[model samples]
Target: MNRAALRLSARVREVLEEAARRPDRGDISTTTVIIWVAAVTGAVLIAGTIALVIAKYNGQLNNL
Candidate 1:
């Protein structure tokens, strides 16, 4: 068990070191903004559709 733990720790350390070597610009591009906008619009449309469907069946559901 101790050997397994050491191996795991060594692997984790290597992963951290590799990740630290990369450069990050930390800037958002226009494509990212457009993708976010589309995602939000899709979510809103799906929610609106669900709301409309529930409203349409409200009377029938209450009768049950």
Candidate 2:
């Protein structure tokens, strides 16, 4: 049982060391930025449309 625990600990250390040595691939590209902007714009437009529709209905309800 002790030998097994030592082996597991050694394996975990090796995996962590390998992960630390790997290079980062974390930069965002221009196309990704454009897509994100478009998504945000679309979400804003949808929310505005819903708000306008609710306001129109609410005004009608108040009149009745």
Candidate 3:
């Protein structure tokens, strides 16, 4: 290959290696984000279930 093509291939290899060695950002690791989302979703579902149950039983509780 010519000098220009050789230089470009070397540069691309360097860039790919640098990217592979880079650390992940703290804000958005896949597993961590998924766990947090699942926890929040569970909490919201529980809260909504409790609210619905309370509403359904409101009149019975009021009788006491």
lDDT top scorer:
1
Window of ten residues with lowest summed lDDT in model 2? 18-27
> Which digits, one per residue and each the tens of the lDDT, describe model 2 over residues 1-64?
9999999999999988877888464768889999999999999999999999988899687888
**Could you give candidate 3's per-residue lDDT for residues 1-64 as a string of tens digits?**
6999999999999988877788553446789989999999999999999999999999999999
Candidates, ranked, TM-score: 3, 1, 2
Runs with alpha carbons beyond 4 Å of true place in candidate 2: 1-25, 61-64
What TM-score goes with each of the models? 0.56, 0.51, 0.58
The pairs that clash in candidate 1 are: none
**Whole-model lDDT, candidate 2?**
0.91
Question: TM-score winner among the candidates?
Answer: 3
| Per-candidate RMSD, Å | 6.6, 6.5, 7.4
Per-residue alpha-carbon lDDT of candidate 1 for residues 1-64, written as tens digits (9 for 90 to 100): 9999999999999888876886454768899999999999999999999999999999998999
User: lDDT at 27 for candidate 2?
Assistant: 61
Candidate 1, residue 17: CA error in Å?
32
lDDT by candidate, in order shown: 0.92, 0.91, 0.90
Look at candidate 3 and tell me the lDDT of residue 6: 95
